[model samples]
Target: MLGTRVSAFLKLSKRDLKYDLPASIVVFLVALPLCLGIAMASGAPLFAGVLTGVIGGIVVASISGSALSVSGPAAGLTVIVLGAIQQLGAYETFLLAVVLAGVIQLVLGVLKAGMIGNYFPSSVILGMLAAIGITIILKQIPLAFGMTETHAFEVEDGGGIAAFTNTIFSSINWGATIICLLSLAVLIFWPSFKKLSKIPAPLIVVILGVALGFAFQGTSFALNPDHFVSIPVVSSFAEFKGLFIFPDFTQIVSKDVWVVAFTIAIIASLETLLSIEAVDKIDPFKRNSPTNRELIAQGIGNMSSGLLGGLPLTSVIVRSSANANSGGRTRQSAILHGIWLLVALLAIPTVINLIPLAGLAAILLHTGFKLAKPALFKQIYKKGLDQFIPFFITVAAVVFTDLLTGVGIGIVVATFYILKANMTNAYQFNIVQKEEADMAVLTLAEEVTFLNKAPIQQKLYNLPKGVKSVVIDGHKSKFIDKDVIDVIKDFEQNALSKGLSIELNDVTYKQKPLNGNFRLKKQKLQKVV
Candidate 1:
């Protein structure tokens, strides 16, 4: 009987609703606190975060090609959003920045710049993940300890880390702390069987947290108002309509507006692209998402979010990973999560407020551990120094500075190693000194750039001064920069004076010297002994 009902439902749902329905509920639970927390951290209205969640679910997921990635406002963007909000001085003015950011992202997609995502070094991306993880763990520590008045403003100059550190330890509530610790225990130690996960650990955390809140009521261990989630209550649809604030076009001319817009667009796009790459690696189905289309979908979502008075949105890895872990099988799971958020707002605003902030903190703390797991470092170290240095530097820089700045520093470090590799191993040099046939074979790398010039020149200079024959081989090379080729030609012209006969094999010469009428004295091609 049940089998027949399931079959009929599967036929009605294209066989996806079964997987998507429960997963959507799980994603909604995961997104709820994150959305509220991010909004609080960004200094935006609480409702704005929820609104972004809806758009990311319904709008971005509907258009995105990714099967598992969930779009919403990200913790990674919190610092930037915080600074932008303070500078703009008005939520509506900040909304203008958000709208402009969406436009810029749309232009980036139109220009086919999604391929830019491919250029980021793995070391840098890993560094970003680690840095954000560390930030989350540290930022949530106080909240988990039941220390209210904890905010995520940057540990900036004149204020430094001390000021931020002092703020967290001032007011401590034992009840919130106990609930948080117990909630983390459940999430961490609960049976992780595939069937067991259907009852998401986070949902359990919220339930327990709310029960704790009520159980300790009228006691010394009672939860503080600051320690609980608070959602605004609206009496009617018109009052709900009054909550949204639109963008201010009048501020569009301001340079700060444009600057913040560009900053948000670039960082948001980079984060989105990185998240897409990260999610694809973990996907059980091994599907690849079209990066360009993701940017376009995100752009549209951000535009809608801005117009609706919400924070900027991106494809967040945290929510997406949760969805995947919860057995979400389609994009329908993500879209349905948004619908859940919308439905909850219209029906259960009071119920949401009963969720403890501590419970949400526990969920994020678990996420933080996953992001910067100790095993990740051990794995990167096994790859050796050429990979580890850039990865470590990226992590340190991101933790100390911001994401964009850390990535910049990491890319520079990665580039240095690349240049060093080119300089040291640009080509292989071998000397064959058979009686009467003394030949030096120079085999160029597949792609020899100008960075390889110095080493190639040095090898040529160090060649046996009395060798009678030399072979500069490019048979395996796909590209040889003009400067490198010029060095070879220059050495060829200069070699004849030392009683050396030259043979150039499979070389593509490109330059002004090669362009003008030029003829080689000998047309011999050399073969390796």
Candidate 2:
């Protein structure tokens, strides 16, 4: 079985090499800055993010059932990681939590809890993707303006609007800003020419920024070292080995550790499921990824990451979407990107450290714009209030609050509309006036439950005195609740006192012997006045 799986994978990789190869390069370029940034934001060692990216790509991609999704240290988990690190009192202790989280995810996958992702409304999911795009744009703005990580941190701590204003007004690197603008221009227009499309725009952006970085050196507009990607350069294998920080197993019994572990597991799993769902929607092939297998893959990746001193990882939409947009056709792109990350980190760290953060920021900025485009908003609005309200509220909530909280709120709103629709559409009522006598027609819907009993009863009890006959039709109903049937029977009894003729069409009650419960069953139409 294992050999067959390997053979199938090799065949797929070979078939899509042309598409996956360049796409992997694009994903690698995109993943680089994000991995570092999420690590910095999480208050962990910068190499931790690179480690997560490597493991997620090589380990998780090999095990996952998804074709295009990529995994890495996610920006969404930064707040939780930062807090967990502080609470645990050491970075090593937090790694223990990450491992425990992986175990929990494995259990969840085994229980088939991945199906929970299917319950999320499409509107809420779309809103979540849009909100993430907006957040990415907001976060990358300072970097695009040639600001330092310190300045970006200030924006994060100070509130997005006020802090962003102060940071941008206080300092600006003209060199980095110029390069960022040039990079954005290249990204915006590069895909327009079909012939040059195979060469990823992000690569050209990096090359342009690197060339400009050299040209502006020693000048007044020169970029500060802080504006460039910073990876610690190691001269020997021993030095590189020294960078790895193992988890502290001594903290395994700590209650705080378990709490952090559960938090990470649930949040990471949710984010991974949501990311894959979004990626599948945009896939040209419209393939359905196996969610349970994805959870298992993520669980193994997180365990390996924690064991080797890396941040927790999840399937990241930013990188995955980039892969898809770049024409990635299979999981090979994700795996290859991880290999590139490992190679770059070990072989030429200095060269990578020289790439300006502004260029990467430009790439992310373009990606963000595509996600939250005005066309998407207009399209959702056209889907009607039922879809638009939940979608809009979800976008607003996610922007103002955290992702999980926002999605939860959106789900509540969507569920409310669903219940409202079910209540209002319980049945169809119409009145007809004939020369001899007026008649009323009441048709039951596909499914009638206890919640619909009040409305159905109300309509029948309030019938006009001039109506001499009433018809209750259940031919279209597949499932009719006992409460609804009781309502109909009581109304018929009430009608007898008013000298009204009543007719029943294809409705009867069936009692279950095991549970002593009853259900409405179809029967021959009958009349009883």
Candidate 3:
């Protein structure tokens, strides 16, 4: 049975490999620059990002059920990792947090806590995507202009907007600028050629960048060495092991370690879940990735990465979208991409370094445009204030602050909208004309909660003294909050004294079944009139 299963698996792998191979190469190329860029942004070792990409691909993909979702070191976690590393004052200590974070995620997956991601409001999620998009553009501006020594990535720590501006003004390399614009143009207009669907724009951009790098060599227009990728060349197995940094177990008892651990776990898991959801939406097959399983895979991936000196890893949308767009059909593409990363880092680091950073910046700039597309903004605006407010605020907050803080702000805004909608839709109080006089009707909605109490109370207290009759009916309500019931009870108890006659009928369906679907449910209330 084992032999037969292995044979069938190999057969399927082979079929997938054919289509996935090309897609994996695209993902690898996209992932390579992002890994290095994010690692630099995070203030960690450059190789840590490559290590993360390798682990995300080989370990995470092997365990994850997501077909086309690619995992890797992400830009979203740059802020978190940077702060944690600075706070801990040591990279090895930070590794302990990454490992602990994996444990937390593992527990969450086992407990099915992955469902927490489902509760995040869509407006906030869209806002997050937009915020990251805008942040990407802002961060890439310096790089695209060849401001290589500006140290703008540190702005995520506490530098804020002013530091980023300083970076742009301080340095400018015209040679890098020329190449960056050329690469951006290719990325922007390359999609018009439908015949080039199989060949990605990023690949072309990189090739053009390498060609530019060589062109500029030993000439008046020669670009600085910093303009190119600076991946450390690992020549042999002996040197490879030296690159890996082990976690400091001694820091495990420190509260900072535990705190940062949970922080990374929550943020990384959230990023992973959001990325998986976004990738699944774009999947041509429309296949659903199991959320809980993805979390577990991510947990293991992070743990493995931490042990081997890597930055945090997650399901990365930029790479996954690149994979899906490149015709990848299965998880093999993701795994193969990781293997490719490992092979490159171990064998051809020098060749990889030939590509220019400006070229990568162009690609990211293009990605930023896609994420913060004008059409997306217009679409959200058309959805009305409820959606736009949170989305816009989230984007603004993320740009001003960091990722987690901005997400918190967006969630708060989103929650406010939820409360607003709930309050508005909870119930209704209207005065209708009757044969003799005006009859006030308090029609309860599907569900009325304590949140609806203030408005409902105000409406009841101002129930025109001239009213002859008032009906407090919840005959159709699925659920009536106790506070609402008490408010109605108090008003009814005083109705007779106020020269009003009140008729109170079924206020809740707590015990009595409705629509032959719900069990017996009813609200208990004593009638005063």
Candidate 4:
């Protein structure tokens, strides 16, 4: 079996080289600016983002079962990373949390917890995503317009709309704003052209920004050096090696570290699982990836990233879709993209430094807009109050508080709705007191749980006075809770005293199975008359 597996992999690699090679380059181009932008958004060293891309592409891709999924630093985690860094007091301390988070992910993979992603309510998940998008947009606004002294998250003196408007208008740098607007234009409209669609818009944005940066040099409109990406420029192998920052292991005992670790592990795992699931749906081969193995790969990738002073990483749908659209058919494309990232980081630091932060900001802004599109709100609202309420609440909570807290609140609200529905739909009770017949019928739903017991009991005891016969039907029920069964038994015992005849329709009981499982016994119609 091992030999056959190896043979098949080798064959796939050889057959897909023509397609994978170009796809790898496209994915590399697509991942480049994103790595720097997400790292900037995360408030980590720019090099950390590149390192994550390298590790995700090379490490995760190597171990992952997914053929086309690409792993890298993602925008979704920027909010968590930013908050954790501030809360932990140091980047090194945050790194320790990242390392521990990876260990947690490894345990989860071993426990086959990949299915946990499916348990999160869809509305809550969508709300979380939309919240992240809004946060990213808010965070990038200052960068996009080249506001130097004012950080996006900072509070101004006498904070209000007037102060914000005055600060923003006064601090706006026309040079950076021009580049940002141009980049946004390309991102929004580039795909409309058939030929230009093949070239990634981000690559074009970077090139345009760099050219404009140089063009404005020595002029009044010249951008500050801080307006561009600032990765360390290393002259020797020793210098390159020294650039990597290690985690402060001494901080391991801090409670904040564990909280940050758990948060990162869960959010990263969820994003990875969701991304891979989406990638599989779009795969031309329609292949299903082993989610457990993907989690294991991501665990290893994140561990390597933490050790190397890199940002947390996950399977990114943006890069994966780019890979697929560019004809990538195997994991080779992802691995090769990592190699390109490493080579660029080592060899072309000068070229990369020329790319403006404003352009990267525009890219992130575009990503944010996609995540929180108005259409998404309309769609969720159309799903009804049960969905929209939780979704809207989650959005508000995340915006006001944090990701984990918001999701918890959303889950609680969603659970309440679920219980309410269960209580109301447990069974259908109807009464017919006509001259021809005075009969009442109680029909059990497909599955009845203990939550249904109260309503069932109340309805059973409150039947109309003129009813001559009462029928309890379970023909459609596959499973009935023991509590509900007890209620039925009690009703049977009291029916005679109420001067009503009792009948059971396809409702029978049997001993619990030998294996200690309780299953509803399906028998012919049983009567208790």
The lDDT of each candidate is: 0.84, 0.90, 0.85, 0.84
Worst 10-residue lDDT window, candidate 3: 509-518
Q: Which ten residues in a row have the lowest lDDT in candidate 4?
A: 148-157
**lDDT at 487 for candidate 1?**
88
For model 4, the superposed segments whose C-alpha errors exceed 4 Å read 1-46, 67-69, 73-104, 151-164, 245-271, 274-288, 306-312, 316-333, 430-434, 462-466, 508-528
Off by over 4 Å in 1: 1-16, 82-89, 150-171, 192-197, 250-256, 433-439, 463-469, 500-502, 511-529
Ranking by TM-score: 2, 3, 1, 4
**Per-residue lDDT tens digits of candidate 3, residues 1-529?**
9977854553337777777998898789879988988898999999999999999998899888899988989887888899999999999999999999998889888988777777777777777777777888888888888876645444565676787777555567777888999998887788788898557787898899899888888886688878888788976789888999999999889999999999999989988887777677668999988889999999999999999899989999878877887789999899899999999898888998888888888887777777788998999999999999999999899889877688889999999999999888876778898778899988889888889988888888887756788888888888887788788888877777777878887877344345566464674465545
Per-residue CA lDDT of candidate 2, range 362-480, in tens?
A: 99999888889999999999999999999999999999998889999999999999888888898898889899999999998988888888889889988877888999998888877
TM values, all candidates: 0.85, 0.92, 0.87, 0.81
Worst 10 residues of 1 by lDDT: 520-529
Decoy 3 TM-score against native:
0.87
- Candidate 2, pairs of clashing residues: none
Top-lDDT structure, candidate number: 2
Off by over 4 Å in 2: 1-11, 149-170, 462-466, 508-512, 515-526
Which whole-number lDDT from 0 to 100 does residue 26 have in model 2?
Answer: 87
RMSD of each: 5.5, 3.4, 4.9, 4.6
**Using alpha carbons, what is the TM-score of model 4?**
0.81
Across residues 1-529, which tens digit of lDDT does each residue of candidate 1 receive? Answer: 9977854532325577888887888789879878988998899988999999999999898888889999999988998899999898988999999999999999888888888888887877887777777878887887787876534334455465677666444456778888989999988876466677667677788889999999989998898787877767788989999989999999989999999999999999998998887777668898989999999999999999999999999999879877887688878899889999888788988898888888888887887788889999999999888889999999899888877788889999999997897788878998887787678888888778888999999989887745678888887776677798778878877887766778888864433455687432322234322
